[model samples]
Target: MSDLPPPPRLPVTFRPGHTRAILLTAGVVIFLVISGIAMLLEHLGPGSRLSFILTGALIFWALAQLARVKVVADESGVTVVNIAGKRRLAWAEIVRVNLRPGDPWVFLDLSDGTSLPALGIQPGIAKQRAIADARALRALAEAHSASSALPHEPRS
Candidate 1:
């Protein structure tokens, strides 16, 4: 009776497409502007120009990190790659998937007493897409966990 779409096939990846594109574009633009300004500043010494270019490169690297956020689901488990860290979880380890209103991204409640933030499915420029992604992920987790659980025991 649920209206949500079926879970995606294994080896699926969920990511904020628009956010990645925008971040990449912004990074390139910022790097170009900084390099251009450095080149145009004839009065600046060579060291200063190099510093400016290096700064631009560093900025681009940081932005690229954010753009790389994603969640990959395979037969083994799900891998969540955030800005600074990546964590892998077995399907049975995920107790629930949450993307409540006003949340920036999806959060996974683990069987352990911990909640993991999944930045890959963020409600940035594409809110609806993020919701769909979250739902799909949830469905995948539920399906996989249910099949893996022993029939004699209840799922926690």
Candidate 2:
């Protein structure tokens, strides 16, 4: 018999759908910057050149952060990757998923008493879809948590 491992079940992913918009905006910004630099190159002093370069780098970094935030969940747990850092938590570790009204994103209430932001489910972009996705994620987390629970035992 073949020894190949079973294929992985696809993880549910949540991310902003503004990829095209973000890319287009970044591209336009870069293009404008290049044009401006070219036009001002002859007149730019050393200090002005350094300032322009630093500002350009900062803008690109911000754009990259905008495109990188995401969340992935599977049977085991959920992983949240934001601009600054990433956090992974097992289903048992997640106490609850809270996406309150007027909130920008879903927040995972953890067993450790700390909340983690799920930036991938930003509600400002598409409110309906965001709400649905958050609901589905919460259900998934609850299902896993329930399944991992111990069978009923006598209380102490």
Across 1-156, the per-residue lDDT of candidate 1 in tens digits comes to: 346678898999999999999999999999999999999999999999999999999999999999999999999999999999999999989999999999999999999989999999999799999999999999898888878974876689
Report the error of model 2 at residue 99, Å: 1.0
lDDT of 2 by residue, 38-140 (tens): 5588888877877777777677767777778888998778999887999888889998888899998999999999999989888886888888878778777
Off by over 4 Å in 2: 1-9, 27-35, 38-41, 45-51, 150-156
RMSD of 1: 3.5
The TM-score that candidate 1 achieves is: 0.93
TM-score of each: 0.93, 0.76
**Residue 116 error for model 1, in Å?**
0.3
Tell me how far the alpha carbon of residue 48 in candidate 2 is from the true structure, in angstroms, after superposition.
Answer: 4.2
How far off is residue 56 in model 2, in Å? 1.1
lDDT of each: 0.94, 0.78
